[model samples]
Target: MDTIDREEVDEVCALAEAGQQDYDARFELSRMLLEPIEDEASDSKMIACCKGCDHCCHLRIEAYEFELDSIHAYYLRELNSEQQAKIKEAIVERYPIVKDLGDQEQRSINVRCPFLIDSQCSIYPVRPMSCAGYNSCDDSLCKRSNDDPNDTSFGIPQDQNIGYMKMRQMALVQMALDLSFEEEREIISGMHRRLFG
Candidate 1:
């Protein structure tokens, strides 16, 4: 948590430098990989369905070191002093326990993300790829999330949007790379390193 470990930050940067950064070559990687999603995001279906719904925003999410680093780097350069301080305060205040917990505990944040502000994400542009990618369907997961906005339980995955789930595996890789965690903790850090860092 000490500012997104420089090592982790370097991994993604190295990837980018080597030109092997997951989807860095394609600026529209998220939009393309999750293609068809671009239109779906704005289409009446998802737009109308998700209006006034902060289900995904409230759910606990996790981030991979690379993805987290990607976000952190973006924020390091993009945000103003006031904005950075505000997000830092929010992150530290929201995850007070993580702040105190040893590296072990910090690895897995089992609380609502500190990055979430006013129930709406404050950092939308520099948000992690995961954030830009996550989309809830009319599936059981969506139903459960809508029913309990505060629920932290894992939801059922959609048949079509499996890519989102796959990308999430990188989070595990990241955590494993940084902390040799034994238990599967409950914190979620879905992207937005800018707001949540």
Candidate 2:
């Protein structure tokens, strides 16, 4: 894919080789893979995702199996005991209802992400690729979409080179899968499992 840089590809493979146990290393690789997509989207003015604009945070977000492990590692390493407990409590409270909702329906629901703390993504640097890929050129459109989930007509101007970005995202996830076994689960449910342990 035109979006896949040879060096970044090599880095992903290297990170995979470093293994899932090295959570920090894997996170570094995720950040590297995401940086280009963010840059390209920003350069194209396609990214209107900003702090305090959490309309999209309610959407269902999934992670590569390895990425989920990384998130758990992040929580343990970065969050205080109280913060961790709070996240767990939120997941326990919300995941059951969310587990039954269809993807689009879940997106329309007003439930905030378990990881969203005070209108900001608490795990932003290592957030899921699905979350990273989301973009909007206009904040109003996002708000409208949130307000009226049935209106699927709302859309943002995506970067023209989205194919490349998609390829990169697939490459990163596939590489992680090759290195570890993980089944895809809804974000809250997955986090609940992780936090429970």
Candidate 3:
């Protein structure tokens, strides 16, 4: 994971609000953010993402137990020891209600992963594969001025692969495959509450 640009969230918020909680749009925005990049080009092409835009941060990116552990590892290194403690504290205090998820839900999606700071994710780096491969390319309801001649998000990119719009993607699968059963089990239970708050 990489550092996010703080400015791009405004575009995401406005468009998301207009979508009126459209799950598809929310999912798409969250998916695109799994890929954090600084050189994807700023063109209006179907695949070209905006620079430093982090609307995805505002969206929920559920994580499995392994992902939560991965983020814990990351914060230990990327953030100060105290910061890591804070994240863990946050998790311990309030992990959302894990719903009746499917079989694979533990692999990539569950309880919002116990890591979020005021709707902003603090562990971008080491954010887990689940956090890296999410994206959506639908264009029927973009918030940018559609009539503007400079806009690049017109029709969806024809050449772009369908993989660009998928969730619980490959990276997530691979990461889950790599976790230990103990780690995986703790994720499903509230036993690891001390790790994140």
Tell me the lDDT of candidate 3. 0.40
CA shift at 197, candidate 1, in angstroms? 11
Top candidate when judged by TM-score against the true structure? 2
* Residues 41-136 of candidate 2: C-alpha lDDT, one tens digit per residue: 666645566779998887778776667877788888888887777788889889788878866678666577888888888887878767777777
For model 1, how does the per-residue alpha-carbon lDDT over 117-178 read when each residue is reduced to its tens digit? Answer: 65655555445444455665554565575565446567545434433333443343344344
Report the lDDT tens digits of candidate 3 across residue range 2-96. 32233445444443454344444533333343443212322225543333434333233445453454444455546776666666665555344
Tell me how many residue pairs clash in candidate 3: 14
Flag regions of model 1 displaced more than 4 Å.
Answer: 1-15, 18-52, 98-110, 138-159, 162-197
Better of 1 and 3 by lDDT: 1
Off by over 4 Å in 3: 1-44, 47-68, 99-113, 118-120, 138-197
TM-score of each: 0.49, 0.82, 0.40
